[model samples]
Target: MIVVLLAFTLASFWALIAWKGMQERALAFAKAGSETQGLTHSLAQHASKSFNAVALALFGAGQYILHSDKSARASAEINDLLAQYAKNIPQVREIGVLAENGDWMFSSFETVPAVNNGDRDYFRYHRDHPEDETPRISEPLTSRVTGRPTLLMTQRLSNPDGSFGGVIFAAIDLAYFRSFYAEFEADLNRTVTLMKTNGKVLVHRRDDQVGKDMTGTALFSGRLKDAGTGLYSIVSPFDGRTKQFAYERLSDFPIVISVAVAEDTILDGWRGDRRFDLLLGAAISTILIGLAVVLALQTRKRSVMARMLRERERGYRLLAENVEDVVTRIDMDGRRLYVSPSIEKLLGWSADEIIRESAYSNIHPAHRELIKGLIGQLGAQNRTATCEYMTRRRDGNYVWVEAQLNFVQDPDEPTAEIVGAIRDISKRKAAEEQLVAANEQLKALSETDPLTGLANRRRFDRMFDAEFKRCQRSGSQLSVLFIDIDKFKSFNDTYGHSAGDDCIRQVAGALASCLKRPADLVARYGGEEFAVLLPETAAINAEVVAEAARNAVHDLAIQHHGSPDGSVTISVGVAGGKCDARNSTSSMLAAADGALYLAKEQGRNRVCVAAENPSLTLVRPAG
Candidate 1:
């Protein structure tokens, strides 16, 4: 019976060790999955931004060709414009404009090469599907001129009659993406892949695998088919090793990014832990067997207890010394009874010094009360309390740290003590701040026009709605100005598209300079048209500002032979009133638009004011 009992105890010990080993294995894989997901997300963002920049260049070049003289298609100005775009955007290798027949019209290359992309997939697709104006990203292909692997981002250009005009494309070197991915490849078995949604790999760390077809793989048929982003495990065909993968699809482009790590690599630490646990269980089994044999010996039992106590103390000391966070014990009087040696590494304060001072001394003055409140909760409710606050280090700099406090009761003592663990969380705090700043920058970019540096139409509409509601609530006056550059299309025809862009920029600057109040908003309402919102301004004031803006543009003295004034000029229309149930934003816009039509009819380069009724108007004569 004694032997059976001893055997049963040994079996249970081994069983418990096995359970813990299983848990550790699961935890290892979970951690790997989380890391892969984060990496994939970051890679997707990078790829999306890079592709968007290329698309912007393509769009600008296409618009320029659509509006400019066809005779200047091969001019030096076109080449210089494309070259400037390539120089500014690091990802783009070259920018080119192709004719409807796939002949290269202009390129950023110093020497123009006679290359025909008539056989290219992007060109053929755009030609065949004339209505599809969305930008197309082609599979990896060798460039005709450079002979380097490149991905083409192409957008179809359209004529005034909506017919297919041509295709404008930007070449992005595959090596650019490969180099960026190389930074994240710290291990040999780790891989980063950028591929098309159709399974053709565009860029890969393994050059040989680039352009490989993966459509039949489980990653495409099972995981990606179900969702845009996901995690899965698969046996790699390259090395026949099982790998865990996380993938994310670009939000604005038809591209996918994947990060993978070998399963064996992820579980290496778990395997080591399992071996150590087996040795520990064997030693404990032997000790139990010997104790069972000497069951009647009480003297040996006392010695065994002493040895076990010493072993436990050694194990605890090792754990405390090796842990990254500081382990601490505090008495009821808020004094540190013990502090782990890691405190020195975390805060530049020695363990002995920390124990000598009050526990709250290093905490920031503003955060001291917060920590005290958490401590009170731990003592009063016998519960755990977690808090994050700034703590001053011995070097006189404050670092963010998180602390978890728990009440620990000693059976033999009258009072309970607090056990706490503190970890330096400065990196996490910094990351949070950076995320907030990025979000603000993204918002700003979304609301502003890239060319003129003024608010875009979307921003104007939003502000219009907000201000309209505010005027209705407060009974304050709201005014709007609709301004147009006279004969802007003829101006573009007189000067090239490049000069037209310059004129628009100059006019935008002059108009912006005329507004003085913080509540005023100037936006590029559309092509050659600008809108201004003036809150708390009356109709007369709006007309005055509009006249100043018209005069401001005339003062620019930019040569515009298309205008009767013999130079660049503007026509302004002003509308203002208190918004009511009947007078809405749309109504205000219509009234302003009518006045603008009248200003142009009476002749260009003047301001027109509209009454509360949208049809009734008065024109301010041109100076």
Candidate 2:
């Protein structure tokens, strides 16, 4: 039995370790891919910035030459410089020089005559500005010469005497930037395009739009300004493929450069990483299964050896199998490494399943944090912890289990483990709750009179002590009523003891039912005598309840076994104090008893109060 348990435990531990390792490896692979893409994006952004700087520098240099030397010979020299530089820089396709009268001084095109620039917005914008040396970048406009999408950069020139000259304009070649970026071999599906601020496709990697207008395409226009230079997802303008893209705008220029890569390209290496993890997991699983089988065979061999030696192998096996409690083993890391067969019956989960899941996960949420803290304490040399917690079941119900944990270091492994037992104590807990309820019910019965189900003498005495202390502390008032059956003895003699018992029961019930507050209690003192205790009550109010009780009992007609008339009545003697310091419960009872004697002396059926000197007079009921 020991050998089999050890084998199952080792297999389960190895499986959990393998699972955690695979998950970590997958995360590492994903992080590596993101870092690689970041490097590429950083490089592309720098290259785009370099290109924009080169274009602006060339335009600024050309405008300077035209303004510094103003003669026709110098003008021809400057125009020649512009045409020659345009050919040298691959991105600068066309450059033109215009005089103050709007006649073209030079051009790169072969058959072009002197061009008029006075009507152009670029020319007028530069010419009207007086001292601003900054150049103007025009929104995309159609070029009559090339018929492709184009942006114009105009730099204002000045005469040698600081007077304004015409503008020197240049049209940057977008096709050149697109063609250069498309030649890269990193990802073939990546699309590169240059677009103008007016949502016109200036150039695309497809190369077929050299003279076409692409203003109406959705690819040319969307919400680009809101999402500044970063990764985004949209349909590709060059190939209509949905993809992830990164874009960067040219500083001090009107063009936006974008690079689009398909989703397949971004996740290119993910499948290989997943496959490698699966292979490792499968290999571990096979090794565990083989080890489990070998251990099972060894356990059987050991059992047979024990039988041959006449040892008690069956007894040991039966003891492990039929145990009534759950036994579990946890490693120093607080992971459940082993669980006994009793767990299967108690929690509806097999030992192997419990071992595979987190020990904290199986505990109810209310107990999970507490168990984690206990495990932390155990790790810090508090080697044992005993607690009762709830464990959630497979069907979503929870059961209480009392766990006893102890620490032991395995000789074969470096880490210590907690070996524990969990016993189902749900039945015990329910019995404890029932016992508590029954105790409370018995306490309530102890404070009540059996005959009238009202507060008894003992209850009245307790309440009086409490009320007296409160009144003394708060300077409040209290009252009491001493009541007696006016002719109870004669009635009992005429009607017999059973009728007397009925009369007492009837009178007590009426008095108790008439009192409203929890502080008001009516108790049967002895045969034919009753009392009412009223807290925070004055003498007059106490007399009111006493008189009401007297009348209620007088109206009672209890069936008598031996009486000539089947009836019962009571007389009350009320006494209270803002209760005077001289007055005690015994003194009050004696005075009320004196009033009762007066009522009896006058006639039966009347309530009376005692004044000074112990004189008693009958008090009539109020209308």
Candidate 3:
């Protein structure tokens, strides 16, 4: 019966520990899944922004160069503009502008024939649906000019009188993303995928699959439609293997990015860890069983028990007095029947004084109730327990101590005395707290931008995602502003790059200062461009913010001989929309980018808000 009871207790304890370890392992996997999703989402976010920027820049260049002039001079200007855009973007094979009749009027390439594109889906979509002015992104198709498979993006070109003039098209090479995945997945048990919202797969690294239609798959019809980002475990229909998927639905572009790792790979170490824990528990239990038998046999030698008990009592008392730990004995009523001399050294209280004073009164008030509860159980038959608590010291300070206790029957009396030992663990506890503080500080530093001493781009992305999610639930509006230091390249050319960096720092500081709301975030979006994300803000309020940021930079009055203003000034674009299921942050950024471009065109150092989606007409000159 004793053996059965012992085995059961050990098994229960081991099971509890095993369950806790499993929870930790599961939490680790969950964190890894989130990181994987973030990796893929980041890549997609950068690529999408690059595409938007290149498209807008090219369109702006075309309009500025070809306004009312289809002459050779204007064609030359368009060629130059496209050259600049294409040089920066490696994925673009060709950029072209078409006339209203769908005839290619100019190409970025040096010598190219004027081809007709009236039958193209992108061109036809813009001509038929002029109201939907957003950039039309099409699936991969063979390009007539480049003769290579490409993904096309087009924006409608309007004349000065607000009439439809033509369409500007840029063909992005699909192999660029495919090659990127090849490099991104190096020797890891991972697959990177890029697919359109229509369930058309553009690139899938593992199977070398491209342009596969996956509209019938549960992955798209189920979780992908609702969640912006999530982790899922399912058996792949294509490969018939269980895989963990970390997927993100891009907010602005109708695209989804997925990173998949096999279920076996993710759980490889956890199973081994569980097995090791079980084996360790078994070994300890076996040792404990052997020790228990020896102790029980020794306890049955009744003839010499009294003599041995006396010798052991003396030896225990001597050892207790010499040790740093304080030993104590209490009766069932909770009175201190015996106190070790070590109490004076450990707690700054004499044994006689501890016995005379209120028993256990020096325990911290916050922990007194817990100690009382534990003390009540000291009357249980031979049951041992351990707990840690903070106790008041002689100097009115608190010290942490770990206490181990058991109830022992008194030979001369009917009652049992609770024997206990208390060890100082204050140093260990302090070290743990210090380690936690250091980790928090390191994490904060990693998220902070060193140059401007503000939240960096990575941190901004995280905050934007979280706040956007919150606004969606609360039915609130989110406003975003894109700011750029006008004529920054000329600033670097006139002054050195060092001076240019100072100008950027000054601009970042000014932009941050203009924001009064705690929910507003300003981050350096690489180089001279900065972004301010405002949560729960309306268009009116955001307009005020954008104008303020522009003036703030102008107020700096930093000299720039190359700029028309002869001083550093910024162009700000503002866009506002409800952060809900129907809208994405990227759309807001695109609108703001268009507005900022308008500000630059209307004249540098101005603020413009989106007149409507995909266009900015109203301009508020910088004050």
lDDT of each: 0.86, 0.68, 0.78
Ranked by TM-score, the better of candidates 1 and 3 is: 1
Per-candidate Cα RMSD to the true structure, in Å, reads 16.7, 36.4, 17.8
Q: What is candidate 1's local distance difference test score?
A: 0.86
Model 3 lDDT per residue over 383-452, tens place: 7889889987777888999999887886766788778898999999999999999999999998888787
Report how far residue 437 has shifted in candidate 1, in Å.
Answer: 17
* Per-candidate TM-score against the hidden true structure: 0.53, 0.40, 0.52
Looking at model 3, residue 466 earns an lDDT score of 88
Per lDDT, the best of the predicted structures is 1
Q: Which residue ranges in model 3 land beyond 4 Å of their true spot?
A: 1-5, 13-21, 66-68, 206-208, 300-623
Report the number of clashing residue pairs per model: 0, 0, 0
* CA displacement after TM-score superposition, residue 364 of candidate 1 (Å): 21
* lDDT: worst 10-residue window of model 1: 612-621
Candidate 2 per-residue C-alpha lDDT over 349-462 given as tens digits, one digit per residue, 9 for 90 to 100 = 988777877788779889988887876667536768899999988788999889988877657567887888789998988898799999999988998878777677788878
**Candidate 2 accuracy as TM-score:** 0.40
| Candidate 1 colliding pairs, count | 0
Model 2, stretches more than 4 Å misplaced?
1-70, 108-112, 117-121, 124-133, 138-151, 158-164, 185-188, 208-227, 235-240, 299-623
| Candidate 3 collision pairs | none
